[model samples]
Target: MRLRKGLRVCLFCLAAVTVLIMAVACSPSSEGDTTTAAPPTVKQPILEQDPPSGETGELETESGTESGNTEEETANGNDELETPAGNRNGSAGQLYALTFEDMMKMDEALNHEMNYIAVDLSEMTQLTEDDKTYIIEYLQGFGAEIRDRTLDQLVEEENPDQSSPSLKGVLLRVDKVEINEDSAQIEGSKYRSGTGAIGVKITLKLQKGAWKLSDSEMTWIS
Candidate 1:
């Protein structure tokens, strides 16, 4: 009986050890089953740069002046007189025609010469405002001048007024006119007190349909 009991106890002990060993072998190994944590994700930063200095990056207007600037600059930059459409051709022929019209508007011939004398005096001497004003105000119109005596009766008169000449000669006459689109060239003859018949070459431009004097640098030769 004692031997049998000891055998049973030994058998039970062996079975428990075998079961423990099987459980440990059959279970998954911690080494192969373990999952590693993903590495922390990194974010990139963005950087911005400044623009260059003293560069406005704005365009200038057609008037040759900058917008949003001073009024003085704008006024100075603007051309006071604009060339007319027909006169913009810059042709000598066109200028001559326009100049003739301007000349025709002056006072008569003799009065025109006197007006020139007055203008010369104004330039040569520093006359008072009253004298200058009088000369400018009393000058003849564009086409005709005024004289004190009549040319027909002057020679027959007993004592002709020697101070004032009766005949009023044409001060200036428009001989020819040439126009080239924007420009005009005029050839005319001018009679002055000291200078006899003097030929004049005038250049004009078409500004707003009216002929005006062109810039000296932009003279039309042809």
Candidate 2:
């Protein structure tokens, strides 16, 4: 009996030890485990952008957009194209202007060459004082004498005999003007000394409401 009792005590103690071993085996093995646990994360902040422009022009942005309008100058030095101012003197005024312009070479007196001007308009029945003034002013700057008179009004001859022939100044005259609707012709003569004389033919046309010199030819040279 005592042996059986001793065996039963030993069995109970063995069972208790086996149960304790099973509990220990079932528990997680934490020995020599070096894996680290993850840390807590913090929330990130959001940024705000500026509002776009509300005006009718261009939008201010980081990328690209062509926005403004560019203005260009017109013919008359203004923003818009405009018709040229009218000349109340009509085609006659234009004729006179072109005739004088032909005489005015736009060069200094000494820098200009002797050439036939336009036809004489002193006898023009339609000529105005303003037209004559324009003719005189425009004919300046050229090396010539502006005469509105006829050949009879000037010295008919200069030093009949060639005695050290000197420059007696140039005298240009144009008369015998024939005007039509679209085209006109004139005869001009230039006389400097007894030997210096030339005959010129000036032709003009009415173009775009403006009288322009069509052609100028030296008919005779002496």
Candidate 3:
């Protein structure tokens, strides 16, 4: 009976040892120094990269001006609406015809030049030097210093009084010139005097291969 009791004790001890080993193996480890995990590091871009090929990087308005920009540059940028070069003498004549008409009202020519009409065509690029010469010739002998005057540089060295032989001249500067096959719209200003200046917008029509003034409006008078 003692031998059987001792055998039962040995079997029970062996089973208890096996159960304790399994529990220890399955449980989370706690042997090393405990440490808290850190989150992943994410880096961000400092500057955006350039756009791909054929894509526009920066945007600009139609009226945006660039370095060394000029009137010709601005006008030629609109390729679809660009006008043919050197095809506008009608509008040119229309701008100066009114002055000629007023001169015609006089019965006779003046003994000496009293008033001057100097046209500045630097802004009107559609006309060439030859075109300018033609206009000057057309307005010649009108009791004014028209033929002797220079259209490109309207300024005279001296601005003399009426009593002097030098005529009181006005610098005619055309700011904008728009022309089509059927019509033309022109904006210009007359530098008569500091206080006697005038700005004009003229609409002209092409009739019989000539530009005739359809209407003229004084935009500003000072």
Candidate 4:
């Protein structure tokens, strides 16, 4: 009976040790499984770089604004090109205003040229060749002075009938001037011999720094 009791005690001790070892092994596996199954812990915050809000909108707005400005500049440049080079200040009327001396010079030049044109004396059929030559030479020399004289003085000096030809030329009296960049319109009265004042419009062009008559028209004859 003592031997059996000792053997039973040894068996109990071995069973307890085996149970403890199994418990220890199962605890480790369970703990490992529990640890693995749980949600992961984040120590440092995860930061991902994202573009600033409205960045694309701001970029698009800036691009549109720049494009609009470029278009406006181009339009303005085209407008500038359309305007004439000399009219940038837009003071053409003032700049091209004629003076008294200029008018006198024009009158003198015109009378000189008209002297030749007036040589056709339609009513004076009895004039000899020598007489015609002498009269033309005399008129060419003193045409302006004689024309500048009063009509009464001219009538008394010539002492001819109404059929006799008068060498007096037309005198332009400028009333208005409209100047462009390189052209001008002169509105004037043209006083012709025997004919009363007539309205005339003369166009002038600038060439080589000088104003030259481009065209002329009689608007009205009174």
Listed in order, each prediction's TM-score against the native is 0.27, 0.44, 0.44, 0.29
Candidate 3 has an lDDT of: 0.58
Best by TM-score: 2
* CA RMSD, predictions in order: 15.8, 9.9, 18.3, 18.5
In model 2, residue pairs whose N, Cα or C atoms come closer than 3 Å (at least 3 residues apart or on different chains), thus clashing, are: 119-174, 120-174, 120-175
- Model 3, 96-199: lDDT tens digits are 55433333332223222336666665555665565666666655555566633443333344644333233256555667768787887777765545555667
Model 3 worst lDDT run, 10 consecutive residues: 103-112
RMSD of 3: 18.3
- lDDT per model vs. reference: 0.45, 0.58, 0.58, 0.52
How far off is residue 33 in model 3, in Å? 99
In model 1, the Cα lDDT at residue 22 comes to 94
How do all the candidates rank in terms of TM-score, highest first? 2, 3, 4, 1
Lowest summed lDDT over 10 consecutive residues: which window, candidate 2?
62-71
Q: lDDT at 77 for candidate 3?
A: 83
**After best superposition, candidate 1 residue 55: deviation in angstroms?**
79
Question: Which scores better on TM-score, 3 or 4?
Answer: 3
Better of 1 and 3 by lDDT: 3
